[model samples]
Target: MAQLLAEKRDFDFVMWEQFNNEKFLENEKYEAFNKKTCDMILTEARKIAIKEMLPTMAEGDKVGLKFEDGVVTTPECFKPVFDLLKEGEWGNLGVPEVMGGQGAPSFVASAVSEYFMAGRSALSSYVSMGSGAAAMIQLYGTEEQKKKYVKRMVSAEWGGTMLLTEPNAGSDVGALETSAVKNPDGTYSITGNKIFITCGEHDLCSNIIHPVLARIEGAPAGTKGISIFIVPKYFVNDDGSLGDRNDIWCTGIEHKHGIVASATCSMAMGAKGTCIGYLLGNENEGMKIMFNMMNGARMHTGLQGLAYASGAYQLALNYARERVQMRELGQPHDAPPVTIIKHPDVRRNLLWMKSYVNGMRSFYQYMDYQEELSKIADTEEERALADGIFELLTPIIKSYLANRGYEVCVQAVQVFGGAGYTKDYLAEQYMRDCKIASIYEGTCGIQAMDLLGRKMGMQGGKVFMTFLAAIQNTIDEAKGLTELADLGERTQKMLNKLGEVAAHLGKNAMSPQYKTAFAHSLPYLDVMGDTIMAWMNLWRAVTATQKLAAKPKGKDLPFYEGQIKTAEFFIRTVVPTSMGRMDTILDMCSAAIDISDEAFGGL
Candidate 1:
């Protein structure tokens, strides 16, 4: 409601300074895009979001989807918003030009995603899911498959969905019971029910293409037998025109906690014995192909977390500045009532919210730049390093941002006081919408296990060592500034402790003692994420310090001062809190695994 997109400074800073768009513009593929063009795209996207999407967001939440007679119907207000997005071609921003797309760089697209996501989380889900599905098709589809689907999908003429989750298989995708039988004509017949499928069924587009994972008859068990397929709601003809409706229908929709505008449908495939699907890649290699999309989706989900946090903060900030309340200490009782923003505690919460959102934006953008580089790096070794770093940071970006972003949203509600708890305000909705981010895209616990168990040990630990070296470089650079120098000392000590933890986990991973060490894995992830963020923010402050020293005194001065102050606040407040968390982790005092299931049966 407070227009979070207009107040976004962190994204601009990352794009212009940290990510360095000039480097991308020089590429032959991105030669048409410059600063002016990027600005125009962002401006247009914001206009569409405010005019078309934001207005429907509240209405969608108020009048959620209704299920009747085996069909799911969305809020009536969602139609116009979906139409505007389709007309604007915003869904095709990063798609290749050969497929009738704008072919923008990933960094630019990431920025656009943040703006849209901040405006309305539910509407953005439709676009992101479609784009993610299109990316998968573009990457692995055969030439004929690409010609049949890519153009329409890129233009948003066709919507897309990923059908991986089932009632029995959520995070353990390998446990899926969906079956695919090869027909004589080469197309496979798919049969299964998929639950919690977002954008699975909607009248917003002419067709819906689903990337489904199923197992072939008599195939090897577990993940080894899994295969990816493209199943459309309607079969496409050789001439690329719609042909016949396939045997896929929405059986019902979930009564979700939030994101009510996007339909989370329960789908039945091959109930009538005619669901046709085409394999995307080689048999038994489906998991490998799907990871391409899952990894991207995980990152985009992190962006959604940041978006909700920023939106909540923006609303709270506006309320704080406008709503009058009781007087602070040292003020005259007769003095006019002042806004809550005048109070130090409220200001502290708002600053914490701001710093966390800003740090996440910068960190996420850096990861996007790494992904783009992985695609275009000239040398194999450089590409390999980029790939490894991207892999290592993905779990952190997803787990840390989702966990902290939700906390920041809670703080934002606190800033709003009583009004925040009521449905009359949007803060409560933001909290509900953001809560799922941690549970989906693999839970925070799963991400921690991935980080500690696999990523840190990949390629004989070279990637972890590289990341440590980067953190060390930040420390070395910060040594010249006294305030940051002290902060760097503490961060380095935490980094040392993390290294020790990694070593201990590596040595005893096979024994039953590993479970004891595993209990602290999540805390290790939190400490690692905070350490990385502090390192990045300090680097930014160092840059701001240099710029401030050379600038003329004016309005520009406050911007630099804000940057410096935020860095100091984060180091003093946040870093020390992370130290305490690390101590608890080292203490290994939690009873999480030791307790019996019956102890919690009261629920």
Candidate 2:
């Protein structure tokens, strides 16, 4: 198989043709960047990803991390690439120039990130967390706080992490028991044990800055009284130099199934009564401050899914084209064996992988564009619309892509046959690595609850209505095109049914059967995801159809034709199943919740 991370042609088509990202150049914030500059940036990023970072992916997974005493050592291959990321300032591309970053547009940064993630998500995690931490500090920290931490974290000179989960608290973050006591020096003495802290303790950087969530001595209980503090592994002096070691220590690291290079450390703080921390934002606002990092982490988790699926698909495609199998279905018995791509079932699996990958890439790029739009919109209403839609779709993007991206990886494995299951092939590793996306940074079930519980009703349901309306507008556009008119009508039916299903779920959620409604929230999210995928595929078909009408030649012809066919495959095949799910959801069955605890059988 080729060492391809993702298809460049598809990337170009999504950004320039589908999104028309050139329009962003007209905005003053993006005026310094033009099409050529953005393309060159992607080119350089791709080079770094493919040549410098890709080699570490397999080594990291195989060799994994080594934890000894109080230190965690990452794979040796990661250090050189980590250095490249810092020296090249690659981690700060999305940060604004005013905040001491490259000031690239969000979509451009997203595209750049996709490449690096495809190369090695474990290594990329180190960069992304540092950037995310710096972003939070830049947003909510005091000027002095920013001065001490932001620049170093942004440049990847120091590492960063968010320590939230304890042995008692995972999804129920409000139930955390970490405590903080105010001290005479205007700092807080913190004590806590945090688990699953990514990049919590790594040798890639000299220092690790932790934004820990803990409750003050006299604060109220639960999430409301929580506070965020800047707890570093080594203290920073006023002169921007290193001070004595802080009390935070990594006692051990988890031996995980995948992404093994990342140090998921079990951290202990104030073991010797010397964990000093400066409060971030204000007391009792930790949830609010920590969410700034959490939300970004969710988005990053979604991208991890997309990257794994993309890399797997590319490998499967290459394998299918080269791996010869049995004779073609309709060929003579004496005929020579054909490549696996010639087989019908293999074709179906490839198409399934293709359509989802295409849809996912487009969906992520759409969100990336919306992030930029929210920032640069001319009016408050415009900004709110962009931001609101992005907000409403966050869980969908995070959960749906995660669940489906894993499915796509499964299909890739199927395409590779027996070889896919072995360590010799990356497909197996991709499967293992992508599984965590659905489980961590908010499980898929938690994301579904967030969607049904809070996001759908935002601003009196206006935001969700707006989201559906945007899909309708695409359906309407597709209806205008002769080639896509049939798919358009079919997709429109799904959209209408989704609205009805939403209403039914909403009614059930508020009434006596609210538990039943919550029981089916995952299914509701699935249907929503399917409908959205159909919408993305249909939109891509419409664009490709229009481009084909212009009579393009060479490779463009097959690519455009493939787009239309992929849409047909999903709409004709997948949407009907989603419709069935919607029907099931409408019934609001209470069986799952009504079952008696004693009736269940266990070992």
Candidate 3:
């Protein structure tokens, strides 16, 4: 409960020294927010998280949402926390100012959200959904639509949910069975059932605005026919007053593995032939419009992973420092029992978790900075390149961090031994909460396919090479530090291997042997993720080294020294493991394809 989201020095290093976020103040859009203002906002958000949200986290999980008589009810403890979030106006930090939003930079918004998420992931669901919905309207909504919904959503007077997944269309969204029929008055009647709708049916807010994907009558089949509609739980009168309830009902609720406090409902729309819906944009462009929300949700999912990992790491570290165990060699029988932190293996695991968690936070923050730059870049070419890099890194950010972050959570539990598996401790819940990050948004396999199959070839490989070049820049900068010289060298080697794999896949994409290349793409993604993370850590180490050298005996000396040690741990221990994956890629293993349907019949 002691707000262990991110260290102050680490956050400052990332914000001022690493990304130089102060430069954004020169732009008119960010001129209203100076470094002091942003820091103040972050501090306030952190306090709200630690005080209001963290206290109810365990209670919310224990007394999760309940569904009966077509209504979903969250735990009693959630109301005050939700009220605190709305009253603080933390929900509207990233929306445009005209719509009652503060228009904060993505970097600051992401950092605040990361802290809250670290405190209570389930409670953070409503805020995340609201922000995603507001972003959709900002990107593609008409002026009237923005005026109608965006303000309410941003202010948290109303909530939002993305209704895309159906019972049969989990991953293959193209196969969605939802349908819509247009009426003479310009409104449409939507009919469908959506499953696993997070924040789908909750009483935390007065209204819930759902962005549903459905196929209009007479439209083409498959993904091209899908359209997005704005369907609210309660209808809004022309005079801007709340009207009668719409016909969207929660038919059931999912008994999920984690985030139990957030209602995951199975909703039936137009079952009573009265679900009125408004089209968001042009017809047959629903997928394109939904991408805006999807991208935001994907980034948030990565942060969710970060949050759980950070929480688990902090808890495990605390436990290791306090829990006593038998002494190792060179200790007398009379010697007092030592804390587990004194063990070499325990230290290794703890350091590994710390290194990866810190590196992931920096990686995610850098992505947020890139997102801000994509919108505020001075030149068209810079904007275009930024957009390209965002596209290429989206899948990596989603898949790599989620997958590896879960690994860290598991390691955190491992550090606790048998005690970690008990419900009496929070580590079990942390592991459960982290599992959903990789599955939702998009599965790791889907992300790997997107990264290797599509993103690698986007814009004729310009984007991919731009990404490689960025990492190369970090490597070049790190070369001057003798401590990181070998890390820089190994990073270059991994990048070269990545390029070779990319070239092989590119050349064989159209050939009969393409399947062989595709078989090992996931491994390639792992290698790529490890390489990029190492590059980020080395860059951090180089900066920390300079700071440590400047003040030989200051209070910050240990902090800087820890940064260097974490970087060395990651580069030396983790990067070497990727060599096996690189070899696996070159071999073009087709074992997955070789397995037949009968082979899995045992399930």
Candidate 4:
């Protein structure tokens, strides 16, 4: 119940010290917000998150969602909390002011997201869907569409969603059965059944705007033929008032594991033969338009992962500090019992969780800063470089944080022992909620394939090499410290060896042995993720080392000292196992690919 969603001290450390976020304000776009303004915003956000949203997490889970009479009803507790978020305009914090947002930098927005998401991840879907859908319209819609939708959506007066997933075509989106036909009017008649649509039928807003994907009749097959359409629950008139209800129907909602308060609906369009929709962009450019939302959602999903992990870790750490257990090792049995935090293995687990939570948090901040930099870069080359790094790290952030987040949940539960497994605690719920992060957007395996199959070869691998060089630069800077020099040298060696493995796998992906290359892609992705984690840890250490050298007084001393210890722990303890795993990947084993279907068993 005591959820300190995110650590404020560390947040400011990374924002001000590691990232130097004030530099972002030089661009007039963000000049309205200085350090004091950003810090105040963060403070206000924390207050709202704890005061309004934190209480809704359990209520939503207990009451859950209802889909009786073909109408999805959310928890009673959610309405007021959602109203607060809407009133505060937190739904679209990072967008430019012209688009009716606070115009906060992506890095600052990430901090707010961490706070809000940690309270109740299920409800955060409403905010994500609203922003994602509105962004699509703002970027690709006509002036009329923008005027009608963007402000309302950003203000949370209207709810929105991405309607891509279907029953027959889950990840293979090209195989969708939805069809679109041009009508006599400018709008088109959309006929499709979309499943797993989040925020598809929420009652928090007056109208739910759905960005649906369907194929135009007689268009090309596969993703190319797909087109995006604006299928609203109720039509909007030219004057911006709500029109007659469209043919959109929420036939049912899924009874899922976690985030039970959020509706995952089976949406029926044109079931009554009256679903009217307007084309978002040019025909057959649906994938192109949708990628913007997809990529952004992937990054948001990474934030959710970190939120879950951070909350769980905090809970575990608190429990460990309070729970009395056996005496310290090497002490007599008659000695006073020590807290579980003093237990060696428990300490190991807490440190492991801490290292990842800190690394992932810093990585999120860094990734967001890069995104903001890309938007405001002075030089074409700098923008392009940031763009490439963003692309390369997007999948990593989503999959790596998700997988690691879930692991952190498991450890948290272990720290709490039996209570963590019971309903009395929060660890189980965090694990259940975190599972969707990796599975959604794309599964871990899919992300792994995307990394090796697409991003590695993109722009002749220049983008990925740029990413490598960024890591190398961090290593180069950290290599100067007498204490951390050894870590720097070892990390460089591991990364250089990783490049070797990447080259070997890259060649194999093009060669006749491609199946084997793809088979080991997951392991290769793990290697890359850990290497980046090492980079983030080392990056933190470099700043911490400089601060400690200054002999900071009071709380600043411990904060800086802890950053160095976290970096040291992750680099020396966690990364060695990761490096050893990469050595195995370098060997290019074919056992997974060579084994026949019968050998896999239970076919």
lDDT by residue for model 3 over 503-569, one digit each (tens)? 8776766678777777776777888888878878887888888777688676578878887888889
Flag regions of model 1 displaced more than 4 Å.
Answer: 1-3, 552-555, 589-591, 595-603
Q: Looking at candidate 2, what is the lDDT of residue 1? A: 32
- Top candidate by TM-score: 2
Local distance difference test, each candidate: 0.82, 0.90, 0.85, 0.88
- Whole-model lDDT, candidate 2? 0.90
Residue range 1-603, candidate 2, lDDT tens digits: 364888678889899888888888788888789998999999899888889988788889999999998999999999999999999999999888866888999888988998998889889989878889888899989999899999889889999999999999999998899899999989999998999999999999999999999999989998999999999999999999999999999999999988889889999999976899889999999999888888888888889889999989989999999999899998899999999999999989999899899999999998988887898888999889899889888898899888898998898998888898887788878888899999888899999999999988999999899889989998999999888999999999999999999999998999999999999999998898898889889988988998999999998999999999999999999899899999999988898899988767582
TM-score against truth, every candidate: 0.95, 0.99, 0.97, 0.98
Instruction: Show the colliding residue pairs in model 3.
Output: none
- Candidate 4: residue 408 Cα off by (Å): 0.8
Candidate 2, position 417, lDDT: 85
| Whole-model lDDT, model 4 | 0.88
Better of 1 and 4 by lDDT: 4
lDDT of 1 by residue, 393-418 (tens): 88999989998889988998898888
Worst 10-residue lDDT window for candidate 3 reads 1-10
Which segments of model 2 are wrong by more than 4 Å? 1-3
| Residue 130 lDDT (model 2) | 83
How many clashing residue pairs appear in each of the predictions shown? 0, 0, 0, 0
